[model samples]
Target chain A: MTMFTVLEGVAAPLLRENVDTDTVIRIERLVSLEKVDLGHWAFETLRYRKDGSDNPDFVLNQPRYRGARILLAGRNFGCGSSREGAVHAILGMGIRCVIAPSFGDIFFSNCFQNGVLPIVLPQAEIDKLAEEARESAAGGAFAVDLEAQEIRTPGQRTVSFATDPNRRRALLQGLDPIATTLQRDGDIESFQQRDRQARPWIYG
Target chain B: MPGQSLFDKIWDAHVIADLGSGTSLLHIDRHIMHDLGGGRGLRRLSELGHKLRNPELIFATPDHAISTEPGRTSETTPLSSGYMKVLREETKKHGVRLFELGEDGQGIVHVVGPEMGISLPGVTLVCGDSHTCTHGAVGAMAWGIGSSELVHVLATQTMVQAKPKRMRVSFSGRMHDWVRSKDLILYLIGRLGAAAGSGSAVEYAGPAIRALSMEARLSLCNLSIEMGARFGMIAPDDTTFEYLAGRPFAPEGRMWDRAVSHWRTLPSDPDAVFDREESIEVDAIAPQITWGTSPQDVIAVDGIIPDPASAANPSRRHEMELAQRYMGIEPGRPIAGTPVDRVFIGSCTNSRIEDLRDAAAVARGRQVAKNVTAWVVPGSYIVKCQGEAEGLDAVFRAAGFEWREPGCSQCVAANGDVVPPGQRCVSTSNRNFAGRQGPGSRTHLASPAMAAAAAVAGAITDIRQLA
Candidate 1:
């Protein structure tokens, strides 16, 4: 897992509400492509034309937003499916941070596991950032400082954010959750030992 | 201490340790996986050099990638063959049970879990698919997990989860005739918006909910994810017990009695207080259907398509306009009588025996409308067998509906059973998101009876009118 300390790069604004994981990475792309190869296929429907040519109208297809490492989105982004391929595709496309007003519960959790940072901010604040991204000549250069829990926008304004402290620590260190959880194997086994006796049917 | 909700009780029972910042290391009672992630998850665990901690608790089946075609083999869908083969090999190698194609327990993970008694009251279950919340109908703390989380569960039969606030959505009043559980849920999502249940573990209660059959309860809970809730539960009662009594994996004899007694105590106490409380009057909830991309973009079957100008904000109006353009639906026009190219009566949401029976009843002595293709894909092989034994398949077949084999056919469109581009489908599946059925495929989410009615009328018709 790659550590997410600070990310500084171009931000592409996809300001559509309820941008579901299905749209982030279609099920067909997920079934057909490897996780590492999903970048080009992210938002395939919106990114490509019927003739397989790039859709220049797409924000990511524009020269300014090319190779964007940050995504400015609307509420309930990644709202459908538990497909981790959605996060994988985003990461493959070089997006390390997503700023949304809200997120689908599972998609939000998946982002942390893949070293992608999903930040929840007020819709008003996101709208402001997206405005700057759209108007900035420097291609929406933004800095997301995980350690400081703040986002620095192109307009020289600093917007603070909040995240789970434990998750924050893990991301800072790039710790594998399984490895950390395994360190407490003693607790898990003891609980199971007692649980098995109390609920034998569940064990079966 | 305050009275605990059914969700809290089950969650508390599974807590192995409380990790700081409101998170807990919870023991997983059951971890269900499907072909889409099962093989990949196991392989990932091995790549990490981690052994399966509790193989016995894991259940794998090939549903997402396998074809629902008659006499379908693992190789039926060439795209899915590799996944199915990998799942078979990995489950075998890891000592995890695989319900292969044609097997009795083979079905959609959510459907098979409850039917096989793997999902029980007061248990914590997780699966790789979003609809895993369907198992919560059995009074379990069930939710979906991403691939990394799936691999984590594969390596350790537990998950580190943030404790979600409790919410109770009580369906008040008696359901009107022709209103199914699917309608009740769709109505709730449409009314509350898709993000209404975000960050909460929701419990469905009240007389209307208690009156539903176990399969209907499953149908209702299956759409929890669509409403932005990872977990949706209904407390265990006589209905739940009856459904689990003689299942293949349920407890037996004295164990069954003990299990029932325990399950009896799993419901919320009379004084139990939730973080949020909501109630819906079910008596007037007509059969609901979605006309736009999101499940929230829904209305009563008899209602007209919503005009984007009525939206609360510019963004919302823009979204509505985009959805209308993509769906090719004309605003201010009646949604009913809109012709459909296909009708799908299957998915974890409404592919149980009860759902099939409801659709079959509508299809009995009727013929499918010309130019409309309808498919009846059962949730599982057992559901298919049961439907066949009850002559439900014959009724559908006689009505010109194709009675296909089990698996999530045309639901996620991963199995090659997709609605063609630019086609409109009346689907019993949970999601109606753009391209959910296939690229450029417009989906109208509805109940089985409603879908059947649409198939017969060759348009979005109200099931009540047909009756």
Candidate 2:
């Protein structure tokens, strides 16, 4: 069974909106499928040099915000194309949860299937998280309790937000829509059998 | 649920049975298979020792990865050939209707369905491609399925699904000149932030929607997936009837009368409720072009690229920075006049005959910019033949754009036809994600005419200026 639980950890901030799948993993950094390295790809063009060294100018390389897990992002996160590879690259990079104001529709569903908790917070709460992440950029550690819906900053200030009940359950259970449907497989089978009798042409 | 709504009627009729815990075994009335993801389903069926259960309910076509390179026959594109072979093999084995390359009905599955009156209203349509929503323009309840589910559909003509909530996008006023359904949908996607359609199947209604031609309606629903909506639709009307009147698969003579009567009853009642609602004024919107990586990261032709620092939300700021750096554009730089190395005007998105005519109208007697390489591929072999017959190809060629063979070129870049790394391309196809065109390449989404105008101007220029 896939691991499904709330990711409670220091939120690492990669605050961006409309991040396309390609930037999450560049075509160059990828050799054949076997040489697939996840960390090297997450924001590869943004964080690394042509020679593959850490760009001191990159946000992740900053001393204060090291080892952050929760990616706090803007509205419509993971927008543009419907590349599943982007989801794979992010999940592989140890990003357990993403707190965004919004997510690209396909990407959000993909995250659920692949075991990424995408918490959609109100813009106001996301603003607070962004501010705290920015302010703690020097010290770099912030706490987010996914179960508590609270963000704990360096100075111990906590912020709370709301998430939808159904989504919360699905994320916590790691139950994708397909898996959820599979839970009622017997019922589905009975239904299909009845349907097949009615439309025998469809059942051959 | 009787007499509730067209949405409710279709939903309940198609739902074979309500499985416990909110799942349902859905009876698919129409199944469209394209080349991209459907081949994997064939492989799965092969491995499982399964033969298709209902081939008549299934229809297959070659689309994605089909090459548009002129003089390069189907033999050159191996991926497309492989996909086509599998599709052909399965269709023959199962007696499913196949729209092969030489078939008169061949085209983008979405385009072919409507033109042939195969995408009927009140049907549940399933396809392996996301843009199956395009079929929903005729009021069908359509959604894209994954490859595994596609196999299930192939084997049973039914797949298990959970119902999605419904949304209504209302547009009340008559659209202005030069702003077609393509622009309206693009503007809505830009305004609603692309993901607004998430968790919902959108029913597009209102005066503006009722005013669109069947082709225009198809264009609107085509990009529904681009905005996170599983499907987008408009209710059937006289326009739908008029378009389907003489099509090959449409109801004939006496059956036509009954079909029109049924199609007339396809719209939702006044009291039908939607889980969400979005309203947009058609007049206020302008031609859109994607600037950043995401389709939502768009600005009007007259607008500037958004600055990360100007963003109030921190996550937005970070995304802006990443988009800016990758796109190689400065903050606050106007999208118009941004240098474009290439301009592509094709794909399932805008490769229809009407779209080509629109672009050709703009390119007539005009020359492409010295620096820009432009391609104008049709959506099908039929379109290509018709274009050549009508001398539209000559118009494009005269304008210095290569009039290509039909395929899904430069849209997903699934084939080898891609822009070189780091170059910026103004494409008429949907999705402008970074590296979408190629590794390190940038894509700018626009209307077909806008792509033509940009090809001429060598940058992102408003088609209105040329008009």
Candidate 3:
């Protein structure tokens, strides 16, 4: 059974724009003969220093963001290459909701298909949320409400955002185009049967 | 009082019977596949004990993992031997058309399809790779499908999909010199903030589009996925027809006339309505560059890195800080003159004739910077042959840029050649995400001309300066 909800948790707080899939997760990792704990390598290069030690300067390592679930990212958050491993790593890390100024075209679709809810907010709102996350890091536990489209911090400082109506409907219903299409199984099967009969040379 | 946009016409035409749950079965005409992800789909087919339902409708090629190094003993050694062999074997097993290394059709899957006249106008095309949208330049409805979905398409020759809302992105006015389609796409991705086209298909229209060469149109449509669009397109016009006319698969004689007639009528009716519309003036555009990790983190060539401290939004602040740290950039710093260790000009995005021509123009009399290593790869065998015939290879060689074999080299580091860790590269391919070129290799997405300029300058120099 699939979990019914619009989103889960967000881990990426930095909203750098044009984040291509190749960078989100490197191809080497994809071909690696290693078992992956998605979170273990979530920004593997950034989190690791030159000598393979933890880079204390990285955002994810900061004490304030120790357990942050929501990731706030810049526009085109997933761009470049279309390796789905980027989405897999993010989803595998147990992140459920990603609030971004925008997402790469293919990565956005991959997120929804993998059960991650990608929320888009205005640049201004994104800036505010990141600030709020930073300021309330000491307070511990920043929460986002998908239903209300509001991200609230400990001090009750809230930022509101908007998702595309159609996308929002799809995410909330947990219906990908395939699952949604299967709902019309009868019509599709009939069409398929007709198409096969008409183009018997092409269809099996 | 609503006017129809090109996107709306295509979307409505492709709609099969709608399933009640806000999704429908989309009728696909042509499906393109590449080695990287198609292997899994083929494996799944074997698991199901089913032969491909419609092998003729599908075509597969090896592009992603094929090593760029010439004279390599085999295609398997550089990457995972098992996966590469899987790709080569499955296409044979399924009896789909295969374009291996020795085949003339061999190139980036996106480039191979159109160059061979396989991607026709008004057809719904799907590839296992994301850049399949490149075919949309010829007015085809194309999108990338995942591994599991690829298996579904392989088995059923159809995909269950939700109808996307349509968006018309019209470019008005003339483009300035040095502002190619790559810059225009980067500009759009920057302006619309990447997700602007989410859940929608964008149709490129207006005077600017009609004026572009078919190759330039492909470059523009190729990056639609970067902007969060399922696909992007330009209505089939004379440029598209002319490019397809002499190609191998394109209909000849009277059939050609009929095909053109049908393609001419493929545009959206004036009365058709789009869910959204946006317009841009090419005159206002500039050669663009991506400053941060995402495509939306872009600004004009003369722009500066955005400072998160001064940002108004919380996410922007976080993004700014992260970008600054990851990219080793400081606040309020300009993007120009950023030193680059390497330059790469080739990919599905801008490795065609026009892109090579633009780069060759910059390389004509100039030499590459001694400190910079550059590679210029053609989009396809045809493109490579044409460039060699035109002496673009000599111009590049004279400028100290290595002329590379056609494939997606260094685009995703799928092939062996990648920027060494911590090295910054100016690349003509799309995406400037952190470590995109390789692990710990920083990539800055730029136009081929800009990449050539960077090769000459050994840094991120604006192409306009050279112009």
Best by lDDT: 1
Distance from true location, Cα of A67 in model 3, Å: 8.3
After superposition, the stretches of candidate 3 with alpha carbons farther than 4 Å from their true spots are: A1-20, A33-39, A50-81, A95-105, A111-204, B1-4, B48-51, B302-314, B328-336
Best by DockQ: 1
**Would you list the rank order by DockQ, best first?**
1, 3, 2
Tens digits of lDDT, candidate 3, A1-204: 133353323244675565566656767777653566666676677677768888887676776665556678877677655567787887665666777766765676667666677778887877776776666545245666656776666566766777555555666666554445446556656665675553332231
Pairs with steric clashes in candidate 2: A12-A68, A12-A69, A16-B319, A17-B319, A64-A140, A65-A140
Worst 10 residues of 3 chain B by lDDT: B71-80
For candidate 1, the docking band is high
lDDT by residue for model 3 over B216-253, one digit each (tens)?
99999998887878788989988899999878666677
Candidate 1 clash pair list: none
Off by over 4 Å in 2: A1-12, A22-48, A52-74, A80-83, A86-101, A111-204, B1-5, B19-23, B46-53, B81-97, B246-258, B302-310, B314-318, B329-334
lDDT of 2 at B14: 67
lDDT of 2 by residue, B320-363 (tens): 78788888899877889899899998876788888889899999
lDDT of each: 0.92, 0.74, 0.76
Error of 1 at B107 (Å): 0.8
Q: Would you give me the overall lDDT of model 1?
A: 0.92
Chain A TM-score, candidate 2? 0.77
Local error of candidate 3 at residue B44 (angstroms) = 2.2
Fnat computed for model 1: 0.72
Task: Quote the positional error of residue A183 for candidate 2 in Å.
Answer: 9.7
